[model samples]
Target: MNVKYKLNLDVYKDRNYESIIVAQNDDKSRIIECKLYADSQPVALSSSVTAAFNATVNNVIVAENVPCIVADNAVKITLAKSMLQLAGMMQCELVLSENDTILTTQHFSVFVNKSVINTKSKYEPTGANLATKNDVNSAIETASAKMIAKDSLLNTSTSINLTSLEDTEQIANGVTISVSNNKITLSGTSTAAVNFYLKLKRAVTLEQGKAYCLSLQNFANIANSGCVFYPANSQKVISSSWLLSEVSAFKNAVATYTATTSIIIDAIKVAIATDRIVDNACNLQIEQNNKSTAYANPDLIKSSIKPELYQAPDYTMHYLYVSNDYDEDTDGFGVTKFNSILSANDSITDNNYHNRYTIIVAQGTYTNLQDRYAGLSDVGLVSYRGVMMKDYVYYESENIYNPQATIIKWDGATGFDKSTLKSEDIIKKCPFHLDLNVHTHIKGFTFDCKNIRYALHLESGGTGYATNWVVANCIFKWGGRADCVDYADKTTVPVFGCGHSFGEVGLIENCKIIPTHCTIGYQNHDNADNSSFGLHMKTGSNITIRNCDFCGTEIQARTLKGAYSDTPNTVNIEKCINISEVKKMYSAPAERCDWKVTVDGNEVE
Candidate 1:
């Protein structure tokens, strides 16, 4: 009879770190728990003499469904259930090898804890007996009309402060407003700073067309400071009105104000500052770009987080948080203040120090880290996304031959030279590999660069790519240089494209990209290969792109790129919002591509 079995590996061993059968009871048994070796051994694996296993965070996983690992001296024979089921079908007939030899297979059975499965109550399907449907549709349709209802969501409460602002004042000349609690008062104060950067310090809005200036005479230390007006839409350091470089310039314009015109500060910024500094003075409140989380000042964030039930022996990091001030001192050559470390500046790997629980970075600007900290290893930085203090060197894309600018990027690699560094080096350095995953989040932030290359480039054994990965509510831009080669002239990549190297079956909801111009032979015209399209629907299904906003940043129209491309991928593209001037740019390219284009409120043709 043919033998069969099923391989099952539970979430017992270190899933985050390198998995090994440690000799706990002098080789009789091994310690099995996830995250044991995470810090030192990033990738982990299950142990078997000659077995195969697939692992997941919870429940049973198929381990070695293919072939059994041969234990030389253990005399353990593991067979798959499929093989035994096939043998039973053959009425217990002895299966012979091709050489007419007795094929003896050991059948191994894997038992999982049934307690792990989440149970739900079962319900009966539709309608009463006899399948009698007494005009249920009509009754349901009229139920709303017959019921009394009121819409509360249509109205939102808003009140303006009559009191004038303090510290500095109006954007317009000859007026200064100050506020004492709710009481706002206006005063005659002229000679406001023309330096727009100064005006935004206290509380002021950034006007696109208006430039509020701040004079340095009144405020001391006017030599190196200005105000910045950062609106809600900024991704990079680019500020509005005179383009603020730092926080000083951005706040300088609003510092000294007039009596006539007042400030229009972003409501969210004030709330965040109030929560962090005013209320919870000791706690940290992340308020860089108030996007999705919205100045999220979580009350008792520690209680919301599970007090980590486990830790790996190799996990080197004991703490993770960047300094409040990270961008300050710089080298004369204008790299990073740490670059001038005539010796080892900051270190995780030091004499008798393999890892630490805390790493604090001094305020400074760092650029082009060319293999300076060569000995650091076994470190993990865990924090919520958009924690604006840290500047990680996430690889953008191929520099073609230049290997620098954001362009077409490949998958994540394993190791890199610290001295001779590339973009991929950052990924290899982060101490811990993740086992827990929160859906619809990768990198937890977006990178804004000129013509960004690969959006997400994780290498083989890529982690964090799962079913609930949501790629939404973001925009990607790319610009072509005046000088370029022939190959790039024809083949512009898509805004977001995952090649054959994706372990994810997630949804790409509400993401947009502008493709480059393509030419014949150089890149495929009207071809999905040349242009990566806004989203790649290759590997896993159950994906959709709904309510997405996309448009080509460049004006060149000879290329053949629209909202999507036809890659014969089985995913739906519904309600895609295309902001392209070209009519053809709005077409959806999937089998279930019945698009319902809604422009504001009206349906498009």
Candidate 2:
């Protein structure tokens, strides 16, 4: 009564594949129409003019007529090598076109794997010309060969000294050298004349009869010269000695260092050119900002020297360690809070400095003393009720509305009653408010602002917009008003608000935020759309949430409202889990343009 069929085409490039097209037909010896299609183009069909199996030379195809023994009422079609060579997704169709009337049809999607490199040559460019096809092919081949050679050159390193070179012809252009009495002398016609660009940049050169030192300086020259050397004087070139051995060792070290440095530099260059360097890992310790100076003496670095009594302050780096072990008043070494130190005037005044100030917060809860003293008070009058009297009450009836006023009438009548009541003495507030100025970090501390607004307000304008701020391995909990970390632009709207704001490159990683005690302003805001979120990314880009614990009792753990401008704000959430009452971790409307939030790995829809 009903027909069912399935077709499967598993095509691997350059290899013959079998395609099965099976359909239901119970009648014995019934003619069934079958055809194979590659990329929607017909490529094969059942052989002969009868209800029999299909056959193709070399290309295999097996067909079963009606009254078949197989359970699927099936037929198998083999694809030829020529058909398989056409690399693309293939589809097969089976139609019963009897008397120009079709009974049933079936279609299937096939996976096609094309060859990585095609072997057959389709074109012949014989004529010689500047831009001819042959020239193009040759250019491609040469480029490929060069790429391979570069890789090999970067992996291997060799060093050479002038001990064995017969003459200056082996040396690079413009280099003046002399070998005499088992020593090699290096000089130049002009300071910049020598073609030792790599080694000369570091100023690593050989001095007559001086013990050679192996270092990065020598590596550059070896890499530049490819370890080729020349001896200018025959009598002085010792050919083999301890000094010559030192020269060789130094040259070898230089070669290794130079090649490795070049490879790293090339990698960084490629990353920067593609504008995707963010995804790449860069080793800042190796080389920084292209600034290098030659060592005055390598031996001094090796020698043990006494520690200086008075070490000059390194303006390039600043460290403020805040711990409860030391008091803010008595001991000068330690401070209690992070924000207090930031509020102080800028002491280190060096414009030439690239400063990295790290504020290590000790493991303890910090409260802003200002928030407790200057917090909102809770002494107010309660509601009042009216009293029934025998006569009319003397009260302003037309326009007066006082819920707390006690009303009195003409004949012992009372209008309203008022009473003073106090429940919460003082709402808790955040101890210290931070308007981030420098590249600061707040780590390993618990911000206990039970009834306060924000623990750290990263608002633009106290000094400037906060950039490169990180909150890692810290606990921000029990805030009364808003998020522990809040962002707002001071240019347009001076004060920071919880609902909407803007930020740039904020990282919240390996931190904990407990939203249970936070006053997130969702009480009267019954509408889910207008409710507050724990980590509200109203406006920002490159805000990453990695390996953080987010716990909240609100509608959602976070929300992405995007930014004011059309430029997309991106927030990447990786290796983060929602350990809260809310099931839906993130909530974002689809209509918002240029706002993207990726969770785990995929973008949240």
Best by lDDT: 2
Tell me each candidate's TM-score. 0.26, 0.31
Query: How much does candidate 1 score in TM-score?
Result: 0.26
> Model 2: residues >4 Å from true position, as ranges?
1-315, 325-356, 362-438, 461-466, 479-503, 518-540, 552-566, 579-594
Task: Give candidate 1 regions above 4 Å deviation.
Answer: 1-325, 328-468, 479-488, 500-503, 516-539, 552-569, 579-605
Best by TM-score: 2
Worst 10 residues of 2 by lDDT: 264-273
Per-candidate Cα lDDT values, in order, are 0.25, 0.28
Q: Write the per-residue lDDT of candidate 2 for residues 372-395, one digit (tens) a residue.
A: 244234325231111111011111
Give the alpha carbon lDDT tens digit for every residue of 1-605 in model 1: 22222221222234332212111222222112222122243222224323322211111122223332333222222222222211100101111122333232221112122121212212111101010111211111111112111123222111111111112333334433432221222333334432222111122233344233321111212232222223322132222332222234323222222223323442111111111111100111111121222211111011111224421122122212122232344211222212222111222223122232222222232212223333333225343111111112111111111122222221222133324433322323211112222222322122232212233321112222342444444434333211123223333443443221122344445455543332110011122332223245433223344665555232111222232323322234466554443221222343332222233445433
